[model samples]
Target: MAPTAKPLRLLAHDADDLAVLSAALQDAVAKIGDIRWDAQARTLTMACNRFRWEAAKGKSGERVRSALQFGDVAGVQARNLRRDAKGAVVELLSMGFEPAEEAPAGVVTLTFAGGGDMRVSVDCLDVALADVSEPWTTPRTPGHAD
Candidate 1:
């Protein structure tokens, strides 16, 4: 008999942005689920509470597992960025984010599953975004979360 397989959990910032995760990434995900984006409001809504992982040993050898959030939606900087599917560098706004000059192109929204539990650390948690390419073949880790 074939082994049980998982479903894909596809996520993206927008239509032009690349999709994170490989075919394996997709296969590992149970499902892509739903995604909602509000470019004007700069808000995103996603259903990502369904993904789960098997219990594993922690540093202390104790069983540990987290019901991590696995999805998000974000907006593209309409001013500095040009909507192109070719995967080129564009200007990402850094005004509301930080003192940086601008964000690279081909990035808008980012979804991360590697970092620890999502916490509000103005210095750490906020600076964990990345520049995503079309189909998300590559991820340029951004300095922070705007």
Candidate 2:
């Protein structure tokens, strides 16, 4: 019998923790419209269909709906991304944090496959990732040339 997997939930309070979240989110895809920022709440969130790299084994794979969120966001900026193209999809490559000279305050960059990026400037490192639904079968796993 195949091994069973459980729902994943993670909280990132610092750079080291964020690295784990980044790995879990690698190859995740999201629609432009699914990404949202609420200025009043100082939060940024994205609903993503994330490749289940952690649970994946052998030839078969799948993706799970997940929510990635950042709190205490001071501002958000995008580069090489078209917010107007709501239907467009972006594949997440990786994520990293650049510390601000002021200490806990810093920028969290979400790098996409097609040279697109979204930077969230935050008051501190505060992020969460959680699988929101059951995984669905995927015939092909994501591949990279490198």
Candidate 3:
């Protein structure tokens, strides 16, 4: 029998923590599964397939469905948030936090490869990553720019 993948849950507390989370999420490819915001809860959640990073010997490429949640969210501004984005492949390029003028929290931006961006204004940096499935291989070869 194949070994079952263990679910992962990661939290971010500050800018540094966010950076770590960002690194883990880098190069992740996914179709925007769900975009949800709760006014009362002050949270924004986006679900997607996150390329799994592993250190297992001989393992090449892998990916797993995952959800990323942002808490203390004051608001969410997104470009190209549509049904078409539901199944279209998107890659997370980078993530950054911009300090707010008055609010203790700041804006966290998630930029994708195809110009799709989601900015979350939060009371504080609160991010969570949870894996939803077992990883499967997607072989890749290293490339070098000349």
Which has the greatest lDDT?
Answer: 2
Q: Against the true structure, candidate 1 has what lDDT?
A: 0.24
Question: Over the stretch 23-124, how does candidate 1's per-residue lDDT look in tens digits?
Answer: 111112112223333555444333322211221123221111111222322332222222343243222111121211333222323323332111111211
Model 1 scores a TM of: 0.23
By TM-score, the best candidate is: 2
Worst 10 residues of 2 by lDDT: 1-10
Candidate 2 collision pairs:
none
Q: Which stretches of candidate 2 lie over 4 Å from their true place?
A: 1-3
**lDDT for position 29 in model 2:** 97
RMSD of each: 15.2, 1.8, 3.2
Instruction: Rank candidates, lDDT, best first.
Output: 2, 3, 1
What are the TM-scores, per candidate, against the unseen true structure?
A: 0.23, 0.96, 0.79
Worst 10 residues of 3 by lDDT: 136-145
What are the per-residue Cα lDDT tens digits for candidate 2 across 31-116? 99999999999999999999999778777898999999999999999999999999999999999999999989999999999899
* Cα error, candidate 2, residue 35 (Å): 0.2
lDDT of each: 0.24, 0.94, 0.75
lDDT (10s digit) by residue, model 3, range 30-100: 66657678889888887776665652335365667788889888888878655455667677877898878
What candidate 1 gets wrong by more than 4 Å, as runs, is 1-33, 54-146
